[model samples]
Target: MKFSYKAIDDVGTVVAGTLEAENREAVYLALAERGLLPTEVASGESFLRGYLQRLELALERIRPVDLIFFTKQFRTLFKAGIAVVEALRILEFQTQNGKLKRVVAQMGEEISAGGSLGDAFASHPSVFSPLYISMIRAGEASGSLAGVLERLVYIMDHEHRIKARINSAMQYPKIVVGALVAAFLFLLSFVVPAFASIFAGANLTLPLPTRMAMALHAILLQWWMVSLPLILLLLAGVYWYQQTPAGRLRRDRLFLALPIMGPVFCKAAMSRFASIFAILQMSGIGVLDSMRIISDSIGNSAISHEFDKIGDKLREGRGISDPLRSAKYFTPMVINMVAVGEESGRLEEMLQDISDHYDDEVEYEVGRMTELLGPLLIVALAAVVGFFALAIFMPMWDMVQTVG
Candidate 1:
């Protein structure tokens, strides 16, 4: 069932949203989870609409920049010796993202109720990652929460920049490809059909290219109703499957095996692992715990799953470098650095160096990819345009010659 509720936020402002649950009790629980106090609750008018709204709310994500800003502010406040609850309260007011503000409010409530900072953060696993929680816990135990937060800000900000760079670099290609697809569809559905009618009335012998185009237009007209929904369903199914564990592993593996972009992605993942691992170590987290945290937080499931085995090997009395050497996802340079760092008791420094190296490599590769893909897309666009033009005009030329 669906329930619509008007709830008061942390600041006593009445906010309204929909929730899917069994009863009023469930609605209350759900609202409480979002740091809201229910003032009025009623059954929703439409079950389907409410369900969709609830799903949309569930999928709403807090942006990385918001997270970085939050962490930076908290770090500054905490460094000045502010109390945890007070800092969280300040953040709740300062934060712009509605969901993040509510999360901050809940964290403040938890802290005020005598919960540990790590526990408060752990309660919202969807917002804060395991690595973040682990580092927070380590910081609290060591009374260095400010430093931990500072490192977190750096990590989050750096990751955000890398992602932004990749996205910006690919924007042109995405636009071009989308336009090409749109043009193809429009011509096939509208232009080709009109031309097909003209050719039919002329009763002229059509060239092979014209025949092929007509055949495609015929198939499109006949099966569009069925094909459109089937294609959408197929895409949705593939997306859903990609979210599963096994399917994610296959997806990541495929991502890393792509020709040009694979190296860029692989380097970026390595950079992330190195940087996070170094920070965790410098934060005084144990190696095994750090490995586990990294495994859980790493974006690529295939690499994370492989990295998880290192912890098992560590438990069996193996060193970090030894296990990493067996992990195929890691490059030889990374393995060697790990070995050297382990030998010299400078693993943190070594990991930081690896991160820096990969960061440069990823940037360079992304630039090169942009250069390569521009020409490739232009050539592809020209080929498609040429094919369509030839298909439409070849028979027109034949008819003109016959008349002459």
Candidate 2:
């Protein structure tokens, strides 16, 4: 049966939402399953009409930085001895994003109604990651939600720093490459045509490069209608391909194999895994569960596949280090560190150390990529311009020398 329900939040605030169930008792069980206490449940098609309306909230995406802020704010509020419901209410009222505010209020209602905070957050997977939900569950089970929040805040802030650094490094090269392509196209399409006409009027014997450039300019000027549509179609096809599962897998494979940048992504993925694994371990989650979470946290299917293999090996009773060593992407140093951690029963600490080390490695690689790409782009730009100049100016120089 479909039911329209009214529930109370963690902060004693009333929340009205809808649910699908077998009966009124099932509705209550479902609510309780989510850590909610239903204040009112009404059956029939009356509530189902509003289901679509409730389904479409503000639709705002929750950003990483916003999540970090939320975690820190919650930690502070919880540490101050404020109840979860009240804390959520305050955040819901104060939050700038309409979507997040509504979500926070919904979670507050669920939690207040006796639902777990983790389950409430889990309901909105688009806004909350599996790692975030898992950590919350671990914290709730261990009765150390505040401590988990603190660690989550730290991990998020650390991730933010690393991401910002990589983005900053990548942004400059992207801009340079884009600019180069634009200038090259502009020169070839417009500027070359004008020069070609001048050379044609003079009836000068053009060099092979100038002849080829003029020929290309002629084709662009005459048949751009066909070329433009063809180009657009090709680009659209490529984009559509990229959006497909097979295409995404191929793209990621190429990205991971790319020189300089590939290693950085690999290191960053491993670092995220280690960071999450450490948090899960410290929060008292088991090794098997921790490894499962690590797969989702990494964000790369190639790496996730390797983790899945490792997971299967563990399920077969093999230890962590041995399974991990088989992953081609795992550096020898990381494998050694995990082996050491296993021996000392300090795997969490070792994982944390590995995370920190990779963070440094990612930073160093970003800097190196920047240093290497700058000169390479400059040389490329110079080469292209030099070629155009030789093509356009070579005939002129020959004529002037002949006149002298």
Candidate 3:
């Protein structure tokens, strides 16, 4: 349940805002812990307001870059000795991103209404991840909000650059595949038909490749109405299957087991896990909490499920390295590196090093993938076009020789 409450702070200032909790008692305890005296607490606003707010949040095009800028600005303002409320007000008015501006305004309102900074951020779960909220909560408790937000800004910016690098590497292959498909379709629809008609006039024994090519074109032309829908239906079925839990697990597992791309993805996932783990730990969050938060952030269900297993063992009081070793997703080097970190009492620093190392690995693998896949894609395209050209022209040359 969410509650709207009016409370008095230690300074005799009144504040009121909304927050979610399991029950009213939970809400009261949360406020009381923050040194606020609740005067009135009630269930949150009308369903219509909730619906409109959700609609706005859904339509918001807020990006990671936006959040990075928000965090950096908030940190700078807070560090400059500006009051939290005043800093938030400045942020609310000045942010160029309309979505983030509104979110900042909402935070300002929550601050004015006596909501704790952590809970205020938590309320906008879509814009702020659990990791982000948890770190903020830690910072609030430790009186290090500015440092925490600065660290978050770094993590968010690093993640964006990593994704950009991976996407950049993939662009060439996408263009090549699109061009290949378009060229094949053009030949089948335009160029192949003319040769096919000429062949029909000759009525002679065509070479095997020519016959096969013409036969394929015939099948496509004759049953295109059926084939097109069937192709779409197959694609749709695969998409639906991949969405299911079991199907998703199996499919993602297959992705990690693939030849070239698999290693790249695995490295990226490991880097992400280490990066989040490091940043959260550096922000003074507990190891178990960091793992739980990282499991949600990694975006790979199979790898995430493995992290869940590690969390379960952490609850059992086992060290991180043991559970990680048992998981297939963790490379032996990672397990050893984690074990070293645990022994050294500088696990956060160690994890940050590991993350940096894998970021380089991801960069190297992406470069290698682009270098290898680009030439392979071009050669494959050439071979296909060559086959089509030879198939059609062979018959033409034979016919000309006979007439001569």
* Best-performing candidate as measured by lDDT: 1
Candidate order (TM-score): 1, 2, 3
Model 1 CA RMSD to the hidden true structure, in angstroms? 8.1
TM-score of 1: 0.86
Off by over 4 Å in 1: 1-60
Error of 1 at 78 (Å): 0.5
Best-first order by lDDT: 1, 3, 2
Better of 2 and 3 by lDDT: 3
lDDT tens digits, residue span 110-203, model 3: 9899999998999899989888899999999999888888888888888888888889999999999999988888887788888888988987
Q: Global CA lDDT of candidate 2, please?
A: 0.85
Model 3 CA deviation exceeding 4 Å by range: 1-60
lDDT of 2 by residue, 1-404 (tens): 67889987677788888777888899898888877778888875755655554665544567788788888888999999998999999989878766788789899999988998889989988888778899898898889998999888988887788789889999989988988888778889877887777777776788988987887778888899999999999999999998887787688788899997998888998788888888888988888887788887777777877888898899999888999888869999989999999999999999999999999999899999999999999888888777788888997787777678
Looking at model 3, residue 78 earns an lDDT score of 90
lDDT per residue as tens, model 1, 1-404 = 88888999999899998888998899999999999999988887655577786787677779888888899999999999898899999999999887898899999999888899999999999889898899999999998888899899888887887888788888999998998888888878888888888888888988888888888888898999999999999999999999899999999999999888888888999999999999999999999998898898778888999878899999999999999988878999999999999999999999999999999998999999999999998888887777778989998898788889
Per model, how many backbone clashes are there? 0, 13, 3
TM-score versus the correct structure, for each prediction: 0.86, 0.82, 0.82
